[model samples]
Target: MKRFPIGILEFLTWTIALTGLFFFARVEGPHAGLCPIANLGLTWCPGCGLGRSIHLFLRGDFLASWEMHPMGSFAVLVIVWRQFELLYLIKKQLKSWQTY
Candidate 1:
């Protein structure tokens, strides 16, 4: 088995995190209607709709995800952008990884 570079590992880490988040977002069963923020007297929190947004995004429902939570989508975009940017840099620095 071949070992990947740090950049590759970083990308994989982020991808795995997203996969977890996606699964988390898709949980819409028994406790779906519960919102602690309502009782806490807070209008919003970063994770307020993250789960639903992520779930909708994984299902390819972009508009629904946006409606659910705009910040999560933005977070996803930033994650992907950084991963791709890191890959580009790796390719440029490592001649052996040029074809990657």
Candidate 2:
């Protein structure tokens, strides 16, 4: 059996993750997050609220999304751009293989 290329795996991972985020509802109430730091009784976590932020941004609540996290919209754009970049790289790699 042939192994899958890392680029393909990465693209799929990003696609699935974003798709899930796009469909899932925004988390409500306190302590609803899965942050390990918050679970550990720490109140501050740099990465906390990022997922909720993305969810809000996807749902068309830009203000709420920004309130949740400043980089939410930017994160979405970067992820999408990376997906396209991965596709381009994967296509180029396949073309290279076809020449052999």
Candidate 3:
């Protein structure tokens, strides 16, 4: 089997994450009602409100974002870092393959 520089599954996962972020940032208010846990009679889960928080953070509402979820900004930073790392890994893999 032959493998390309970037795998389809990995590319799709990042694309989905970015797409979700784009929509979340544009939508108003907390959309947590769509969460399965919310429907399961749980008022709040550990990850509850994180999506809105991230959206707020992306919209420059840092204080409001932190108020919604303290780790929201951190999570965003981590996601960005992960993307960079993925690119780096792909580059390294391609370089190694070229030496074969």
Candidate 4:
């Protein structure tokens, strides 16, 4: 029962994290906020190019997006998969509840 709300929250949390990752990456060097990951380590992290990639994506520049991250395509696929899985779980939950 309570699992339903937990699942919904999990979906929201990840989506927010993804959106924030995109925005944070888009900024120029030396953003005024906190990002311990970029600060504590090298300039290039796994998410280093994500901002540029996201900007390009929003503008419908597919090539530029891919240029920013070679595995940018995988990122999109993973996001879609996560969303679909969440929806599937919700649907299954609702169906089970109705049968009870």
Better of 1 and 4 by TM-score: 4
Model-by-model lDDT, in order?
0.75, 0.86, 0.76, 0.68
lDDT of 2 by residue, 33-99 (tens): 6778888999788898899899999889999999998998999999999999999998888777777
Query: Roughly what TM-score does model 2 have, to 2 decimal places?
Result: 0.81
TM-score of each: 0.63, 0.81, 0.73, 0.65
Model 1: per-residue Cα lDDT over 21-76, one tens digit each: 77755545644546777558687766777767876877788998898888767877
For model 2, the local distance difference test gives 0.86
Across 1-100, the per-residue lDDT of candidate 3 in tens digits comes to 4477774457568768766875655445444466788789888887877877888887788998899889989988887777788888887877888777
For each predicted model, how many residue pairs clash, with residues at least 3 apart or on different chains?
A: 1, 0, 0, 0
Q: Which stretches in model 1 have alpha-carbon errors above 4 Å?
A: 1-4, 30-43, 96-100
Segments in model 4 whose C-alpha atoms lie over 4 Å from true places: 1-6, 18-46
> Higher TM-score: candidate 1 or 2?
2
lDDT of 1: 0.75
**For model 2, which pairs clash?**
none
Q: Which candidate is the best by lDDT?
A: 2
Clashing pairs in 4: none
Best candidate, TM-score-wise? Answer: 2
Worst 10 residues of 4 by lDDT: 24-33
